[model samples]
Target: MSHPIHALYANLSARADRPALSDGDTVVTHGELIALVERAAADLAARGLGPRDRIGLCAANSWRHVVAYLAILRAGAVWTPLNPRNGPSLNGEFQRRAGLSLTLHDAASVGSLGSTARPLPLEAWLDGLADGVPPPIHDDPAAPFALKFTGGSTGVPKGVVQSQASGAAALASLSAFYDFTADDVNLAVAPLTHGSSHYILPVLAAGGAHVLLPTPDRAAILSELKSRVSVTFLPPTLIALLMAEADFAPADFPRLRHVTYSAAPMSPARIEQAIARFGPVLSTLYGQTEAPMTVTGLSPAEMTDPALRASVGRLFPGTPVAVLTASGVAGHGEGEVLVGGDLARTEYLDAPELTAASRHEGWLKTGDLGRLDKDGLLTLIGRSKDLIITGGYNVYPAEVEAALTAHPAVREACAFALPDEVWGERLEAAVAVDAPFADDAALKAFVRDAIGPVRTPKRLHLMPALPRNPVGKVVRGDVRDLLYPVDPQPLEALR
Candidate 1:
């Protein structure tokens, strides 16, 4: 046992009889899970795969997904998890690009993968394998264990190469952040290809049970809450939906200790409503694919104060997070976020030039522009690329959005810039509203009074809902498109 999976495997024997996984109909015990992992690993090797070989898994959330991931790592293969909802063509293209040899897929996501890899139906593969011990693995700590895909909200997606040490550090940070224990029963709702999957592993590492939701239904999750689901994680959009749809008296969710939210910025108004409804169980974390589940957490306790709700959270105990300005000083109050720790990814799968430009001496430069307040809490301004230049002044979209979303009628907001001959660049705002405002003049006046005249957009585009990426972050480019049909740049001049 020379890997992190081995460390987890060594601990599973103590909790062998405990329930390790549940998928609505059946519960798999810790012993059964271990046996399945070992058997799957042996079977995979018998079928001509070897250590460090990449295996693609495209499936909905289920016990099978969890088991396959553990089995792949135990057998010393890289697990490339793909979104089952991405359809067969996109999934197939990604598999082809990754040069995968085999793929295990569930019935729901068994899309036409063309000929990239030999497709094995998930259950058929498991049932057909002969049960045996998992093969021995001697993987380097720095070798990649998983190829996590980026959200690709702005441009082409890239396969992020995450090393074993990074994954181990992620597990450690999650365990410390959540303060999870053997008694915890974690409920998962988001796609496993995203943050929800990583958040559940620490529960198993602590000998707790993980319940998978095939779909994140409002009714079903509320029902599950009635039972003893001690902890869970949902994105802010889902959190807002659940709050509006469910009945949350103080006693409604007593069984839940921590209901974590992330993958997007949450409104303070929504947080106020959630705190009143959920009784302070709501928490949030700031994470990226490079370093996930525990970059920073706005804890349940910290969330008790509404003033701190707007702040993302302070850094975890051992992570190295700094605000580096244009001057490159780590002590800057407002600038780009630089993450340096074993948890950060050093490179993309195949993009060396992009990787070289993105990293500063082994530190992952998170392109987020934000300020760390005197209290040491990191408050994100916006992505540096989203900065709006108007009348020779810098305006961050998040600040303007904060003002728009503060109005009772506004649900979400986005601000973008278009080239202007007079101002160099002009600001335009888009808003998704719950109710109609008086008029554009009234709305502009509201923003002008709330934020300032300098930050106000030259035009406002009101819509039913703002377009969002898969992980729930609002796409500012989409907002820009709503205002300007063609390119907003000046012909050969704006650049």
Candidate 2:
């Protein structure tokens, strides 16, 4: 029952000379990482920061962010990692909600937050710390450790409270599933603010090396893969971009043992391309910010399973998952996915209603709509909130969108329900096509033949590009505004 921070310290003590973290030119050994965290803890303690107190961190993924995170936990304070790219209004709102007394930022991040909050730069803060030895503190596993914020598609970010026990349990489950060891090296490509970065905690706990790529550049990431990185996590969009960039073969990443993907579903074709190019090293996980690690995972072998290619794989060991419907509960067909286990978050920081609504009894009601097949593999339908009730029938947008994207001419597609006078709601699809089809009628006919009449989009609009958020998730709100234009007739009539 040791705290995660304490567990990290133990790993450092066990392998002092082993490399623990790397950022481009800088490499920190386990011993050096411990020293840096201790120094930072001592400095923060001097500022009167202690257990349960919140410290806001607005910095990019770097060695500094890692040191500060460990130090915050070491000093017995809750660390709130903010996206450096967020606007002042959002940052201010988060700071107020979290009751943050001190803020830490890099030089550039400070400028973006305006001049009012003259925050201490992380590098300077680390330099100014005393060289005092870190005092021995009892490791309490149940104490609050970090507050991870996530907006998902709803775009209303809420802080998910994580305790030391929950963190350790997640790390333990990951270690067990992935077979992590002291020699393993994990390359972090996504923002540290997300659940994907939580995988790093387990790597550190296992005394493994962590190489961070703060920038989302494909060439830079490929260069690092050629270096010491063994395992890495990537969203599907990044993997697609990498696959399209070069004539890469499986031998390109000789040392790479695994490539994990989450945050969004990957098309079967894209997944096949990745697996064929990288060998059978692709792993797809399904989970959310409230539960930071894998609720279920499609294993490397399963990726090759013709039957399971469309599945999200079986649930993780020790985690309980089920599908429930509007009539209380359902089984083996389709419903909202519910999860309950060691990895579940305690509660939202300030949003009690959200906490109650999302977490009923002990199971967290993941808004994702999916179901277990006869063989027990989970197949994601779509988010319940994203379900289109068209013509009084439940239509999952993911199913329709997948069907649309399956067309050779379509590059990407997003289907959403729009209000209609005749039907309660009708489905509209905005697609990004690679090139103009023979005609609009021909393209519409192609979709109708591929997905059948019921799932066919009522209206199809050709867009130059589909709008995406920073993390590459399609901005449905923007898509809605585009497909259902405010004044469609004025422009059409003028033409």
Candidate 3:
């Protein structure tokens, strides 16, 4: 079989001038996209970036950003797309750790990538795009394509090294599950630096158009969804925020075919509400940066059944997903989700100890606790790191958060455990809602009924909003830090 890049090149021959990428008034055709990539490849060569030399890209969502990514690949250099939101010091630190030779950045990141990356401003380089054709190199399927960084949702973000083979496998797995057509208009809501950016490749491969939304401007997203978007990916929080918008009528998104949501724990009740509004278009994806986004996906069709709608859906073809219990025994039921697959990363960049710790036997321990039913649909429990054990009872925060969000007013909820003198830890809930939770007592009662009294939060605090990483996964640690300030408040002042 031809490689994805080669296939993309082949597809360009048939639809040479078709819209490949666009941002506002600017639209680049497939022919233009290929020419830009080749020219940019020459620019990278002139700047001395080539095979085995790693580089970084720091830019927001733009067609130019996509061209830069493809150009890096075309030049046979490794590209790592870092979140441009990072400060210069932090970006420099990551660059040093990753040992990037160069970094291409837009105006927003040009200052942030100083000294560490032999920083190259994107505009200055684009102005000098070479007229000569790009020299071709043998395509190695096993060669590293891109180095992806995980959102520091847990802690310090780590870089995941992925090869072209794994990326192709991921694309193939998703294509089998989703239908991407030339007529589809893919909306780029997520930043190009993030994993969701990978969605653009399949669309391009399908001879479809990719529309970029640099920022998640709520109005712009709503307008795009209502008019042009056939496929788009939104994190759970963005989905919630858009749904909460006053003018957001589900019927407005008549053109939307697939709206994939993931990267965070979405409330089941909220998902059901979303499905009711947008029909079965809302898909829940379950994957980590380690897997590069295709472990399992809950399709709109499977979402029709209430029981299946709440699931993250079954594993990809030939992908082995096992839930290992505390004893490290794999089972079909509940435990840590261990996945052994081609898509999952086997090593962490510069962290051998961490890499060894994460993988068991041949399976990579996903750190996510989940269960698979007899039919193999996966239901996320909670992050094993965030699991709360209080009064000798195991409490998965996702369960409590789901219960709390089940309340009509609750928009988002996160539960954690605090140290206690008698009990090992006491359960605490921090909730974000449209309005203040009127009765903490009644809310606790609701949780108690849904889960047990042991899992109910002893203290419930209201937050205007919860902290989240760029990808929309709740930064549980940040929320915990905010909820419990230093020096501490008196017991009476709490809640």
Model 1 alpha-carbon drift over 4 Å, by segment: 112-115, 373-375, 470-472, 488-493
Model 2 Cα lDDT, one tens digit per residue, 1-495: 556676676545678889889998999998898889999988888788888888888877888888888888788888887776666667777777777867888776775553234367898888777886555564676677787777646557678888776677667767776787887899887877666567766787678989887778888888777667778888877887787777888788888878888887677667777899888889877777777667788878778886687778887777777788667655466788887776675678887898898865668888888877655689888887776777777788888887777676666788876666566667888888768865677767776897777788888888867877544578666688766668333322221
All models, RMSD in angstroms: 2.2, 3.8, 3.3
- Look at candidate 1 and tell me the lDDT of residue 189: 76
Q: Per-residue lDDT for 40 in model 3? A: 88
Where is the poorest 10-residue window by lDDT in model 2? 486-495
* Cα lDDT tens digits for candidate 1, 95-194: 8878787888887776544455578888887777786776787578788788877887655677788888777777878888887777889987788878
Highest lDDT, which number? 1
Ranking by TM-score: 1, 3, 2
The per-model lDDT (C-alpha) reads 0.79, 0.76, 0.78
Q: Comparing 1 and 3 by lDDT, which wins?
A: 1
Candidate 3: worst 10 consecutive residues by lDDT? 486-495
Query: In candidate 1, how many clashes are counted?
Result: 0
Clash counts for the predictions, in order: 0, 0, 0
Clashing pairs in 1: none
What is the TM-score of each predicted model, taking all chains together? 0.94, 0.91, 0.93
